[model samples]
Target chain A: MTTEIVIFAVLFLIVSGMGFVASRWRRPDDIASLNEWGLGGRNFGSWITWFLVGGDLYTAYTFVAVPALLFGAGATGFFAVPYTVIVYPLVMIVLIRLWSVSHVHGLVTPADFVRARFGSPTLALLVAITGIVATMPYIALQLVGIEAVLKTMGVTGDLPLIIAFAILAAYTYQSGLRAPALIAFVKDALIYVVILVAVIYIPTQLGGWGSIFDAAQAKFDKTPAATDGILLNANNQLQYVTLALGSALALFLYPHSVTGVLASKNRDVIKRNMSALPAYSVLLGLIALLGYMAIAAGVTPIGTDVNTVVPQLFDKMFPDWFAGVAFAAVGIGALVPAAIMSIAAANLFTRNIYREYINRDATDAQQASASKIASLVVKVGAVLFILLIDPQFSIDLQLIGGVIILQTLPSVALGLFTRWFHRAGLIAGWIAGMGAGMLMLYNVANPATHHDHFGGSAFALSKLGLDTKMTIYAGFLALAVNLIVALLGTVIAKSAKVVDGPDATRTDDYTADQGDPRVHDLEVTSST
Target chain B: MTTPRTDRSPWNWLLLLPIAIPLIPALFNAVEPRLFGIPLFYWLQLGFVLVSVAATLVVYHMTRRAR
Candidate 1:
């Protein structure tokens, strides 16, 4: 093996060791309850939540696919920056309410909140299924990040990925959420260092930032006019605004994002982290520029896999040792989110599906055990998903995931703000939103990639009989349909005096603080 | 939902500025006036992140006492 591969192996082994030893870090007497196993005992303070939620939100997809998008499509790829920028303020509005209410009832999943708020098992089930389905392909895409770095290192085939996920599954099963929470600290440290050096050092190796932007501008000047430019145009501008706003709205609705947020100990932990977590956006903005850096360095992607462009840039610019560190940063970045995602998915199953449907009498210990097993199944399923699909499809995995998850926003996010919508209305909205989203996605064809259906998130206005080639985000349109149907449905249902399900949550529950006496110790709602 | 300050705090309105600031095409659409070799398009959006942090901080500070 080359020195680069050796160094990367050593770092990977070290982080894997950290994952194994993480269960003992806090050393809970017994992690056989949902709160203890799935949420790190709900005691994480500000700094840990900052790292946890930040690490969870910004995954290997951000590292690999984002830069790749910038490298390929130019300016519109920058929607990620504004999306992340808006997400914090947007989340701070609704998520603090979620945190307060979840703590008061010891709710473990978004579905749990839905169950209590609407008193509708069916709506909760839909939200749970949506979260799981949306997150699965996203987990598979993380493997693509690791695969890109490994491919850059001249290692091919599926063995290495299988082995890496095996180790990740094992520790997550043993340690649950603590595994990812502990390793996030190390992941962020390495990512920060590598990105800091690459942004500062690599520019000097080239002419400078002046030439870098000039090179990028010059390259885009020669490309097609559709979304490819150093700046936005009228054709792509609507897409930029709608995509950023839609993604920001969808970020916290994902189960894994909620998992990270729900693990925080109190309102202040969330408050402080919401403001402080944008510190990473500074890194992400710099990281996005790595695409331009690759352009400046004349780094070409391996075999048209734009995902490999950033890793290829590292190999061509940084020394072998630092490249190994960068590779490990991305590889570990995948693992942290993957572990959390599996745990989050598993929690939804155990709490909302498995316990609710299969075994209503399951105790807290039984639920925790079920969650651990389900986490393993989730990781294995994600691994199989990557093996089966085109690894190049990582970009769309996230897009489709975003489109699917945004359907739940009307139920989960708007539900947090108001109880005006009937439960039946929320259920009908999910179906309408999901159906409309898929139909729109089914029509989005990317001729470049030769993907005929579900090819991208940007839907052409021409398809709807508009007089232009301009496009808007599919999720944005789907959300509009969802809201309209829900509004009309609520009016119809309320007027008909259709029996509304009983709401278990009190108004005060939305504002409950950490030390509130009403908050249950564990989510062992055996007979709610 | 009934909490007076949590739901109705006027300070909460400040948070909307950061979110709305970036949506305007006029704000960061130019290549002129680049910073450190970065264009206004790039640096300005990164600057919006700081804008959000500041807005969230002020809201949190102003409303924490009410909680």
Candidate 2:
């Protein structure tokens, strides 16, 4: 084996060891309980939570795909920076309320909160199913990130992926959320160091920022499309804004993002971490610039996958040893978020589907065991998604995933502020939002790729009977339809005297703090 | 559950600045006005990250103090 491959293997082995050892990092009294295993006993402080949440949100896919998108299409790819930047403030208002309410009610998933808040099991079920569906593609894309690195290293076939994931499944099954939490520290540190070095070193080598942008601009200017330049055009301007805004709305709604927040020890941990987490956004902006650097270097992407650009850039630009480190950083980055996404999806299933549908009175041990098994199933499903399906299509499906998850914003985010929207109304809103989102996704196609359905997130404004040639984000339009349907449904339900379900949560639940009477009781009981 | 602190404070209103900054595409949508060779569109959006972090920290500290 080459020295690069040997170093990559060594780093991979180190992280895998960290995953297993994480189970004992903060050994809970009842390791089999859902609270302990599913959420690291909800005892993580600000520093650990910062790394964990950062690792969870900024996945290996971001490392690979952001630059890939930028390399393929210039300014549009930078939407990710603004998306992540705005997401912090948006979630600051939304997620703290979620954390407070979830802590008071002992809710483990966003769907759990949905069930309690709306008093509608059906709505909660939709939320759970959406969470699972949206996350499946996301997990698959993480595999795509790792696959890019593996392909760069000449590691082919599904065997390596299956084995790598099997190890991830085993540790996550044994360690639960803590596995990713512990591994995130290393994954994030390596990524920060590698990216910081690459940004500084690569620019100097490429004859500084001016030449890099000049090269990028020159390349894109040669392209016939008006939207491919260094600056946004009239056509893409709306698409860019809507994509960034829709993505910000959808980010925290994902079960994994909420899982990361709920895993924190207290509300203050979340508050403090939100302030600190923007440091990663700075990293993300620099990472996105790597796409420009790839352009300046004239690195040709391997195959049709733009995702390979970053890995190929590293291999061509850096020394073999440092290239291996960068490759491992991307690979390890996949493992951290993949582990968390599976755990979050599994929690949704175990809590909402398995327990809600299969056995209402399952013991804590049974719930934890079921989640572990479901987590393994989730990993296998993600691997199969990559093996059997087109990965480029999977990337598009992630955009569709964002659209689907945004449908839940009304129920989860708005429901936090007021219970005014009727449960039936919320249910109807979800259906309308989901149906419209999926239909739009189906009709939008990329002519170049020849994909007939689910091609991309940008839909033409003219499609809605407008005369304009510009396109807006499909998610934004679908969300608008969803809100209208929900409002209309609320009026109809109210006039029809639809009986509201019994609310299990109390008023104080939304504001419950660490030492509040109700929160303290649950904490004391869970620890014992 | 009952709503938690429905009234908004002026400090809480500052959090809206970050969310609002990126939504207005016209503000930083150009390329001619570059900062240190980076386009206005890119650098301004990146600069928003610091502005956002600062805004969030202020809101956090103020809200925590109020409580």
Candidate 3:
């Protein structure tokens, strides 16, 4: 085996050990309860919560695909930076309310909040299903990230992925959320070191940033008009803005991101982390430049897969030992988020679906065990997603996932502040938004790839009957349709005297803190 | 049950600045005005990240004091 592969293997083994050891890191009074197993007993302070949430939001996908997008396209790929940049401020207002309400109600999932606030199990079920479905492709993308790194290291086929995911599944099944939370510290630290070194060292070695940009510009100038160029022209400008804003809105709506916030100890932790988390966006900006660096290095991607640019760049630029460390960073980055995504999805299934439907009277121990088993099943499904389908298709599904999850924003994020829309109206709006989004996604075909449907997130404004040549983000347009339908539906529902469900949450619940009377201790709840 | 906040604090309004920075695509959508050999589109966005971090920090401190 190569030195790179050997170092990568050693680092992976160490993280797997950490994942197993994490079950006892903050050992709760009872591991059999969902509160302890699913959320690290909801006792994480600022630092652990920072690493955990940071590690969760910025996945291996960010490390690989963002730069890959930049390497392939020109300026438009930088959308990841602005989207991540804006998301912190956006979530700062939104998530503190979510954290407060979830804490007061002892809620484990976003759907739980939806059910309580809207008093509609059907709406909550849709939220739950959306969370699960959105997360499945996201988890599969993590595997794809690892597969890219492994493929560059000359390890092909499914064995490496299966082995890696097997290790991840075992630890997650054994320890639940605690495993990822613990492993995140090491993962984040390694990624920071590797990225920092690459950003500083690689540019200097390649004759400075000027050459890098010059090379990138020269390469793009040769490509056809409208797609290439180092600058955003008028045609792609609207797509860039809408894509960034739509992503900012959709980021926190995902179950894993919500799960990260809900796992914190208090509102203060969430707020502090929000302020602190923008630091990653700075790192993301640097990482995106790696695409330009690849151009300067004359690093041709393996095959046509642009995701291989980063791995190939590192292999060409850095020494074998360091390349191994970089590979390990990407590989471990995949495991941390994948573990959290599966746990988040499993929590949704257990709390919102299984308990709501299958066994309403399940004990705490039963619920925890059910979540553990469900996590395994979710991981297996993600593995099959990568194995059975095209990995590129999974990436497209992730874009659609963003579009679908954004539809839930009106109900979940908006409901945290108001009950203005009737629950029925909100449900109707979700259907409208989802339908429009899917139809738009279906009609967007890339003739180059022979994908008759679901090709990408960008659609021409002309397709929507606008005369402009500019294309807009599908998610943003779908959201617009969703909101209009929801507003109209609310008017109709209110005039018709549709009976609204009872609100389970009180006014104070929206601002509840750790010491609040409504917030139950995990130990106390476990014994009940 | 405690009532929700009815009085909107001005400090909370500062948070909107960060959200507004990247929404205007025309602001930093060019390549000529490069900083340290990096494109204006790239470096300016990176600068916005720091601005956002500062805005968030200011908002967090002010709101926590209010609470």
Candidate 4:
């Protein structure tokens, strides 16, 4: 009925149609194959991989959450900008090795790689379950961004979300990786246009940077918090740096991030993508400035839900129709990444857990089928995460994910470079890291607001009773504990002469060309 | 993993500039002057994006040729 609604409806119809038809965009002759269906035949070129990985890594959440945090917290939120910038170099170190090893071993998930790397299926199973648990809420958070846009447009009923997700599910089921990969192209294009326009347009309307900075400074100075605006200060600087470093380490470990890596055709593609991917961080910095721009424009922070600030700013600044277009950009942005993450998580469940534990000798067809079914279930779980439970719970769960995935860095990232850590030691490290991180996170609470649910700091030196306030992410502390314990455990294991399975079949295998005859693609399916 | 270079390229050292350009303003907030009819803070930050793009393009080309 309203102009915003009309524009949104038209945009939704177009995107939904793309979602449905996306299932057929790169149809393989075989419909039942996981490699063909889940992974787009593992043959994306540089350009497609660039867009797909970019879209997956930078979500609507980044667009919304980063700016929202900047809008609310000031300079502290800028850590995201730096974390994204350094992520490329960090990824460059690990992913190339991961590509070689995974390519050589034909590993589908990081857990699979761990299984081969350590010759310990139990360790691999823990890694697999961790990936799934961490990713589920991430998928849900994507929906929250979409939900904010819909709620702003006055589309409150569950029907639209259900319908929209139904379409996403159908297309993803139909097309697998190609569905999200193709949709990512559209998603990134729209985001680029919207952000470019906002950066240029919003400033002029708000009377430029001088007024914005003054307004923000004035507001923050008067507030009880010592710092003005969202920038980090002495109180939070350690938290900022540690959180950024910890996050960069954790980013590539996510199943979806690995999914992007494994989908690349060869080592060269992986290397090229790593060097090129930092470009998104540049975009992210510009994106982060929208928070400051909003401050200058006198944009009021949206209530409770931080994701709505950008959408609200668009609605207030742009005409109703263009706002709808921007809304569609944000809405569709969530869809592309959510689809990929679900599929990646589902693949982990099928290959590592279901087949390894539930049925030892499941055929490739059965594995593929299991993943497909599991993907649907994953989507359903994500939907309930947002729709049934409090959205804040899911966001907090995402923070927990930050801690959860960091535990893998000791295993996956370190394993990429060396086997010195020992198999038993790596397993001990993972458990110790996980347990310490969770307990610290559980004990973390912000006393000021009485909001106790999501209080995990990147690190708090004060908590450990050191005189100097050395801020670090809780994950880093957990990781340190892991390393110490693992070292002790390894020395003990070595002294005892415990049996260690042979190192993954071929370390040299990773260095081989993708065209090698030994490189055979495997498909997985599950029997109902 | 690829072997670490024994001799690092000066160009790789130059890579740090693009990363630092945006932060320089914060460090020298007292003296930096405005440019292009835009405030110093705004213009410097915008320049960071341009520098990042150029640097990213360079990295992409270099990596592609490394093969």
Interface RMSDs of all predictions?
1.6, 2.1, 1.9, 5.3
**What is the number of backbone collisions in each predicted candidate, taken in the order shown?**
0, 2, 1, 27
B1-67 in candidate 3: lDDT tens per residue?
A: 3554432468878888989988787889887688889888889999998888899899878777344
Tens-place lDDT per residue, model 1, A1-528, is 277798888998998888778788777777888767887776776677777788865687788888888888888888888988899888888898898888787786899999999999999999999998888777877877887888889877766576667777777888888888888989888888988899899999998899999999888988765568879999999999998999888889989888777767667667778888776788788888889999999999888678899999999998889888888888888888888888888888887898889998888788899888887777777776565544333666777778889999987898888899998888888889999998998898866566677667888989999999798999899998888888889999999999999998988789777666776544343223
lDDT per model, in order? 0.83, 0.82, 0.82, 0.70
True contacts preserved, each candidate?
0.69, 0.68, 0.79, 0.11
Instruction: Please give the ranking of all candidate structures by lDDT, highest first, separated by commas.
Output: 1, 3, 2, 4
List the pairs of residues colliding in candidate 3.
A508-B2
Locate the minimum summed-lDDT window of 10 residues in model 1 chain A: A519-528
- Give per-residue CA lDDT, model 3, range A403-520, as digits (tens): 8789999999999989888998999999999999988887787644566666677878898788888878899999999999989999999999999988999877787777767786
Instruction: Name the candidate that leads on DockQ.
Output: 3
Grade the docking of candidate 3: medium
Tell me how candidate 4 scores on lDDT.
0.70
Off by over 4 Å in 1: A380-393, A520-528, B1-6
Q: 1 or 2, which is superior by DockQ?
A: 1
Q: Model 2: share of native contacts present? A: 0.68
Q: What TM-score against the true chain A does chain A of each candidate get?
A: 0.94, 0.94, 0.94, 0.91
Task: Give the Å error, residue A230, model 3.
Answer: 1.5
Collision pairs in model 2 = A506-B1, A507-B2
